[model samples]
Target: MKDLLIGVDIGGTTIKHGIITKEGTLIDKWEIDTDITNHGENVPYDIWNSIKTRLTDLQIGYDRLIGIGVGAPGFIDPISGVVAIAVNIGWHDFNLKEILENLSNLPVYIDNDANIAALGENWKGSGQLVSNMLAVTLGTGVGGGIIANGQILTGTNGTGAEIGHMTVIPENGYHCNCGRTGCLETIASATGFVRVAKQWIEEGKADSLKVRLQEQGNLSTKDIFEIARSGDESTNQLIEYILDHLGLALANLAVTLNPAKIVIGGGVSKAGEQLSKPLQKSFDKYALPRAKEACEIVIADLGNDAGIFGGAFLALQKS
Candidate 1:
């Protein structure tokens, strides 16, 4: 009979959900395959059905639920709960909050997936103790979130923290999905990491990665980092190049927002100190002296759950 919250994180492949207490305790979690067919028309229905089933199984009445919070990809108008577009999910000008609220008769709050992850980290993960922090996710692409004075900055058009699109190499830079070249995403994301490694190898920069790439016919950021860890000079240099761009982008963000902690997450972050050590060195070099002295960079602690936790926090705030 305790008040509970539902957190939903919508991704390209799956939808992750969690039942959490008002106090930020995650009680249960589950996931459902994302049904992006038919322009994602069934997404809201699927989420509602899943939540009802879970609540029934737990003997929790609908009246005990305070609200629902959703973290979705793409541009979102948090004030209106309308998703302008989510290419991955095929949503265009979708009123996600209204759809879910009409279906479940519950108040709903929504925001960008990365922003919610930042909120989750600030509330219960690595940034728990910091009131202001920046959360960066380095996966197939780069995503970022900014928290200032304990609130997510959703800027005009909800694109404020789209840090991936920040141009790092204005000249002769790789093309980004945003239809631009030289974005930080082009050089620092997992895809970018592999692209650079492949390009370097193709240019005849012989290294241990060349053999691995020849054997596997492809390489992941993990594979590159593993080779670098083995002291492959060429691979190490590639990592340094990647971190240099990433560090510069982060440092620029630091000077602008002056966050107390920078929490990094996502698949690429699994490289650990192999990534963080050099990343910090580069950050220190580019960041303002005062900002450099005040901030610390750390890895995300909650992993995939950060989004769900963040969703719950949003629901709690609205309730």
Candidate 2:
């Protein structure tokens, strides 16, 4: 019988799972809404039940299944598969591995979502040629994963490559949800872009964004990017700020890690060259010439499926 690996990605709102062969071909995929508010403490159990129910629904025998891999949002212990902390999910010191193993009777592996996404990209996405690369996800908050020499590089304490939290300003800047000030996420994330745009409107700037906001009642990140594409001055300025911050952050990573390519994938990255063009230029400005020359900042090839595909691949690799 062929070994089958199960991969699960636990996000703030959803849990995505995929079953795959050892060679990385996806065989099945499914997702469930994550009840972070009520069941935050039992993330592992929820994750296990999700997979068990999905596999059972598919009529796959437990004996034919191999190990499981999970990608979660938080500080994760790669060695022990414990979720140390996740601000959004309200989980701390979670022994995810023990709980999942008990629930499913399968060997399980878990890591931060960004790291597994990077592994997935390296295995099947845009970073195929590059041995060293970084994966940055621009969702509600910016998340990053660093892979070096074909291995996921989680530093001591399993908190390495938190690119979003890197400081872009020193004092008197917008505060981050992580209780910090001047984090890059404050300037570059989806929330940060809207925050800056709202301030512009408050400053009496004229733009289509105000009209859109008034009509739509709320501004999503996609709305802002779309408005910016129309050459709205206020929104354009905000995009410039986001690009600068993102570029500076990428430059710092380039100098430090010397990765051959930086792969960007997220809801924000879908903006395409509307984002990458300015971002590439900004990276050139902030990064050292040699580092800039050595690295290529490119958009992430994978879409929403990256998490599921990467999660599945991580499980297969571990097994």
Off by over 4 Å in 1: none
Q: Evaluate all candidate structures by whole-model CA lDDT and list the values in order.
A: 0.93, 0.83
Residue 90 alpha-carbon offset, candidate 2, angstroms: 2.8
Best model number under TM-score: 1
Each candidate's clash count: 0, 1
Per-model RMSD to reference = 0.9, 1.9
Over 4 Å off, model 2: 37-42
Scored by Cα lDDT, where does model 2 land? 0.83
lDDT of 1 by residue, 155-243 (tens): 99999899999999989999999999999988899999998888898898846888998899888888998888888898898899889
RMSD of candidate 1 to the truth, in angstroms, is: 0.9
